[model samples]
Target: MTKLLQWLLGVSLLGAVWALVAFDLLELSLPRTYREVAWPIPLYLLVSFGCYSLATVGYRVATFNDCNEAASELHEQIKEAKEDLRKKGLKM
Candidate 1:
C-alpha cells in the first residue's frame, strides 16, 4: 500500500513536469510548441517506472547490511526471548 502511494505520487510529479515542459512554462530555451499538447502518457509512465525502480534499488543497496549483521540481530532477539521465558519460570 505504501509502495502504491509512492508510485502514484511519483507519476503525478512526472506528469506535472511534463506538462510544464510541454507548455513551455519553464522557458529553458527549448523549442516551443505552438500546437495543441498531445502528452504521451505511455512514454511518461515508462520513464517514471524506470526512475522509481532505479531509486528503490539504490536505496536498498545504500541501507543494506551484511549477513553477519543480520545474523547478530537475530541472535540478540532470540537471547532476549529466552531470557523472558526463563523469567516466566518456563524452561527452554
Candidate 2:
C-alpha cells in the first residue's frame, strides 16, 4: 500500500510538472488575458505541489515502519479468521 501510494505520488508529481511546463510554454507563445496573473500562476502551482508532496512524503516517512508491519499483521489475522469461519461452515 505504501509502495502504491508512492507510485501514485510520483505519477501525480509528473502530471503537475507537465502541466506547469505546458502552461508556461503556452503562456510564452500566446499572450492571453490576465497577463498580470501570469507570473503568479507558475509560482502558485509550484508552491501548491510542493506543499502536497511534502505532506505525502512526511506521512509516508513517519509511518514507514508501522504501516508495513500493521498491514501484514492485519492480513494474517484476517486469513486466520477466515479459516476459522470456513471450518465452522459460517456464511461469511
Clashes (backbone N, CA, C under 3 Å), per candidate, total 0, 0
Off by over 4 Å in 1: 1-38, 69-92
lDDT of 1: 0.78
Instruction: For residues 1-92, write the lDDT of model 2, one tens digit per residue.
Output: 79999999987887676565556645555444445455466678789999999999999998877578889999999999999999999997
Candidate 1, poorest ten consecutive residues by summed lDDT: 29-38
- For residue 40, model 1's alpha carbon misses the true position, in angstroms, by 1.6
Candidate 1 RMSD to the correct structure: 7.9
- Alpha-carbon runs more than 4 Å astray in model 2: 1-33, 67-92
Q: Distance (Å) between predicted and true CA of 41, model 2?
A: 0.7
CA displacement after TM-score superposition, residue 16 of candidate 1 (Å): 21
